[model samples]
Target: MKKTAYITGGSKGIGLGIAEALLKEGVSVAITARTQNDLVETEKHLKTIGDAEVLIIKSDVRNLADEEKAIQQVVDKWGGLDFCIANAGVGRFSPIDEMSAEDWNSVIDINLTGVFNTVKAAIPALKKSKGYIFTISSLAGTNFFENGAAYNASKFGVVGFSQAIMLDLRPYDIKVTTIMPGSVATYFNGHTPTDADAWKIQPEDIGQMVVDLIRMNPRTLPSKVEVRPSVPPSARK
Candidate 1:
């Protein structure tokens, strides 16, 4: 049987890119997102890739039950999950002075708590397969900046959470990795990905990195990876 992966936020952006790469490697993939419409569109697009199995579940990762249901469905379809990528996240930029409690809560709930839910749901199956758990954090996790208070807090929390889980699951032979990526050319935070953003990282770059991590020997586990554009426009400017 082909190895199976579950990706949250797989409807678009980096999550979708990872799914594409994994499918090309002949892995069965299951993705979860909030909208059925978006999930349908993603499923349709993934069909063009070949005969790889694709599962789409409409889920709001903020809900623990929904996360569990999504995982159960994948297990039922694929027999087991070999990888779980917690990529469901959202960001809203505003300085602390202007950031509302609701915005901060929303960011924390989805990005951090949602990951907790995803990991918890996948833990049992992962333990059985000695599977990998990958979290999509950001440079904001470690670097502070203005107008990014909520996003930064959530990502920082994610980094901490991911590392702690790494320790918790190490004895089980389950690998945990946190990927902290800098600016990427994606339709994120109101910025449309454009050719001009060529100097920035691309979603596919992150996806390829995931594949590389998977191919690594089990004796060596890279617990954290920090990725940024080799030539960031911010530095050039």
Candidate 2:
């Protein structure tokens, strides 16, 4: 039987890439985003790929109610969830002195609290499947940079939260992994990915990594993965 995977922010970017990768491997996958039209369109595109079952739920991770609804819908349709990718996130960078409290709250709500809601809603199902949970963090989670205070704090919290959950869920046989990727070529920060940006990691690269992690031996848990471009811009320049 095909295992089921659920992902947030799955309308595009790393989340969508992971969905595509798992679909190719014949896994039933559900994807959620904040827009219904986008979810419908993504569902259509995914159907053309393989026979994997696809469920599209329009959800804003910032809303706990929306997250619960999406999770319940996936569980109802797929029977159980074997994997979850809490990949929905946003970034708004400015000097800490200039950053508004609203911006900080929104980022924390969506990035950190949203992840908490996703995992909490899915835990019972994940526990049943002896599943895996993944958080799409960033290098910023570990290496702080200027103007990244809010974004860094949220991701850093993700790393810590996921690690804690890894220990909490071990007795239940569920695996947890945190994927910290550096400069992926995705439509983030209002920047669109282009062919010229082949030097950066592709969303599909992260997707492939997720698949590999899922397939690893149950006894071997690579709890944290830090991936970076083999050759960075400074090295090339």
Residues 75-113 of candidate 2: C-alpha lDDT, one tens digit per residue: 888788899999999999999999999999988998999
The positional error of residue 36 in candidate 2, measured at the CA in angstroms, is: 1.2
Against the true structure, what is each candidate's TM-score? 0.97, 0.98
What C-alpha lDDT, on a 0 to 100 scale, does residue 41 get in candidate 1? 91
Deviating ranges (above 4 Å) for candidate 1: none
Each prediction's whole-model lDDT (CA): 0.92, 0.92
Clash pairs, model 1 backbone: none
**In lDDT terms, how accurate is model 2?**
0.92
The clash numbers for all candidates, in the given order, read 0, 0
Candidate 1's displacement at residue 123, Å, is 0.2
Tell me the deviation in Å of residue 182 in model 2: 0.2
Clashes of 1: 0
Measured over all alpha carbons after superposition, the RMSD of each candidate to the real structure, in angstroms, is: 1.2, 1.0
The alpha-carbon deviation from the true structure for residue 88 of candidate 1, after best TM-score superposition, in angstroms, is 0.8
Per-residue alpha-carbon lDDT of candidate 1 for residues 1-237, written as tens digits (9 for 90 to 100): 379999999988899999998988888999999999999999999978857899999999899999999999998998999999999999988888888999999999999999999999999999999999999999999998899888988999999999999999999999999999998888776678878988888888888999999999899988989999998755775
Report residue 55 deviation for candidate 2 (angstroms): 0.6
